[model samples]
Target: MKKQELIHLHGLLAEVCNHYEELSGATVAHEEYSELGIRPTSIHKSKTDHKAAVFALADGITNEMTEETKEPVSAAAD
Candidate 1:
């Protein structure tokens, strides 16, 4: 992915983590790392996993959309 895309994904992951914390009453400690000026390794891993899952979901949606369009590849090539 491009740098912009990766940044966007990171933002999305942060949003997801915030939502998760809100829903489950779980503390996402990583969100507060900046205040302490120390980054936690687990936070990066968590963000990466979240971004990957989001990408996979997007891929699924794209595949579904393509199938639903009913445009044959051969016909489109003509």
Candidate 2:
């Protein structure tokens, strides 16, 4: 693919990552502030693990496209 195409794809992927991040943040916030005290209703933690993976991938592509190679850590110690 051409550089232009790569840039476009990177932008699209960034958009996807941003939206997913919003959803994930909202889920966490709702759980935190609400009085329901309900546990995760879905396989959300597992799913969020993949969200970070996907964001890292998109960031990698964007970095490559922009020559901005940043190393982001995605691990959490439990």
Candidate 3:
């Protein structure tokens, strides 16, 4: 895929992962850096690992956001 395609795919994957994590109330863990962001090189790793890591981070952010919002989580829709 072209660079732009890859970037777009990465974003879509992240959004899906975030939605999953928000609905499931699960914590997703991945690598993080204090000063610099995730290494650009790592972003292009073998598809499996790269995708997994991206999703995991998205999940983590989603979970955190949900918790901070203080909204009650329910399995059944009201």
Cα error, residue 12 of model 3, in Å, equals: 0.7
* TM-scores of all candidate predictions against the true structure: 0.39, 0.35, 0.42
Best by lDDT: 3
- Number of the top candidate by TM-score? 3
By summed lDDT, the worst window of 10 consecutive residues in model 1 runs over 31-40
TM-score of decoy 1: 0.39
- Colliding residue pairs in candidate 2: none
lDDT of 3: 0.56
* CA displacement after TM-score superposition, residue 14 of candidate 2 (Å): 0.6
Give the Å error, residue 1, model 3. Answer: 0.8
lDDT for 62 (candidate 3) = 64
Residue 33, model 1, lDDT: 32
List clash counts for every candidate, in order. Answer: 0, 0, 0
Question: How many residue-pair clashes does candidate 2 contain?
Answer: 0
What are the Cα lDDT values of the candidates?
Answer: 0.49, 0.42, 0.56
Ranking the candidates on TM-score from highest down gives: 3, 1, 2
Query: In candidate 1, what are the lDDT values of residues 13-66, reduced to their tens digit?
Result: 556655755775655444233333322223444455545555554454445446
